[model samples]
Target: MTAPAEPPRFVVMGPSGAGKSVVGAALAERLAERFPGLRFVDADDLHPASNVEKMRAGIALDDHDRMPWLALVGGELAAGADGRVVACSALKRSYRDAIRAACPDAVFVELVVPAGELGDRVVRRPGHFMPASLVASQLGALEPLDGDERGIRIENTGPVDGVVTRVIAALDAGW
Candidate 1:
């Protein structure tokens, strides 16, 4: 008899205001219907207190401050036996590399939003540690997925449901 297909591991990645959390959560919920035990993890919750404090204080994090946290996120993704979806501001190629180091099979879904709109969304968001001021820094640091990466990018305008539908389609297409 044939073995069942392995479950997918996904990182919903982008800059700070690119709707990673919302999109990742929704995607996990939808996928869980088909892949039982799939879990959604918001990488923001994985941040060390110092990192959170740095963001809360409007200070952009440097590589020294971020590497450990990225390692933790990677470990979490790698530890998922069934399937996992994580929302993370994996802005730099090096950061994504860090995650891939731990979970080489991980796929990515990057949500793209205009800089102006991203700024607006972050400013209006409440209680989030990352301030709107950091949006520019994130955009400046962002590296879109390389051609060889296993992933897809979708414009994240209009309703969220539409964006989710696009993600599902891309996954169906074997992205």
Candidate 2:
């Protein structure tokens, strides 16, 4: 008998207000249909209380503040038995590297959106600790996936289903 294909690991990444959580959840659901053990994890839930408070106060977290949290997030991804779809800002290259260190086969999917739209979306999102004001900080910190990165960049200006479709297609194409 043939061996079962390995479960896919994905990181749905983007700046604040780029719909990482929403898209990641949807992607996880779709993936679960094809890969029974796939699940979704929100990186925000892994943040230290202090980090949450800092972002809630509209303060941008420095690398020092993020390293520990990133480590925890990476550990979760690495520990997943089947497959995991995680949503995280992962704004800098080093941060992505941290995640890659944990799950080397993890594929990244970057959601690209215009700044104005991102700002609007952030302000409209309810009960989220990340303030709209911090959107600019996230944008400033964002480092687009490099040439060597195993990932695909999708524009999120369209409907959620469309974006999800594109992501799945890209993944199937070995992006």
Candidate 3:
């Protein structure tokens, strides 16, 4: 008989300030409790120091600046022995494609939030390299998941627990 299918890797994706890191961590925690072999990572930690410095100065990253970082993120997910949930902006379709190229089974969880709320969230967040001014650029760069992509899009405006619950439900439903 065939071996059981491997658990899916999760990419918690969105524009900046959509709570990818928090939600991804929560989702990974719950999934690990059930799956027993799951890990969570924030993609920002994979960024190069130059990229961090650029964002800290309110500079938006171009594809040239992001490609290498995306490769590292994808490599980390692909190399893991257990399932992984990663928080990444993945702002463009091309960026997602790059990740998929390395980890073909990567499933995205696109977090949606209003631009105004995103701006406010970024402004209130301390110590993050990304500035509130870059929210617009991130929003502009965002490409919503395509109909054919393996993922779900959920609104993240409500309570964090509620959002995590919905995401877990969707993953269970194989959406």
Candidate 4:
């Protein structure tokens, strides 16, 4: 028999400079067309002022600063339509775990770029509090996806369509 369809709980995650937003938007469009019932939620808008303050000051946030925000994102995921894309910077395993604790079927897609590319994007891109300098701190905080049961890593190094195609291929591969 054909396998049971994959459960739908999609999260796009990675470092700030990794282009999660772009891919998530593309994914959202694709899913909305294909599944139509899918919903897309960008996690950036949910960031609390505290996170904003920390990032504004160029201070890397610790998990303590992330718990409430994580919970809020978690709630959003739990409450989402069965087919949905959650665009978030879920950098660490613990954080992703927190999300899964709320919705066990969640799938994480890590949008990644090389450090140099990340820096270039951050510097060239206009009007974002996450400075290029924070790349190091963010890299420091990122846990490799290898150890996680629910992670898929995709490089966000080229055009949006190309990256989205790669992501879609990865998703098709079932991580």
Task: Tell me the alpha-carbon RMSD of every candidate.
Answer: 2.3, 2.3, 2.4, 2.3
Query: Model 3: how far is 133 from its true place, Å?
Result: 0.5
Q: Which pairs of residues collide in model 4?
A: none
lDDT of 4 by residue, 10-106 (tens): 7899887788777897887876666656778888788898898889899888889888888888888777444668898888888988888887878
> Highest lDDT, which number?
3
What tens digits encode model 1's per-residue C-alpha lDDT throughout 1-175?
1123777788999999899999999998988888889899999999999999999999999999999999999888888678899999888889999999988888899999999999899988898999999998999999999998888999998888889999988878776
Stretches of candidate 2 off by over 4 Å are 1-4
Q: Which ten residues in a row have the lowest lDDT in candidate 4?
A: 1-10
Any runs in candidate 1 off by more than 4 Å, and if so which? 1-4
Candidate 1 steric clashes: 0
TM-score of each: 0.96, 0.95, 0.96, 0.89
Error of 3 at 13 (Å): 0.4
User: What is the descending lDDT order?
Assistant: 3, 1, 2, 4
TM-score of 1: 0.96
Q: Please give the lDDT score for candidate 2.
A: 0.89
Model 4, residue 88: displacement in angstroms? 1.4
* Candidate 2 lDDT trough over 10 residues, lowest sum: 1-10
Screening candidate 3 with a backbone cut-off below 3 angstroms (N, C-alpha, C), the clashing residue pairs are none
The C-alpha stretches of model 4 lying farther than 4 A from their native spots are 1-7
- Candidate 3, residue 61: how far the Cα is off, in Å: 0.3
Tens digit per residue, CA lDDT, model 3, 1-175: 1112886588999999999999999988988876678899999999999999999999999999999999999988787677899999998999999999889989899999988899999999898999999999998899999999989999997888899999988877767
What value does the lDDT take at residue 40 in candidate 2?
Answer: 94
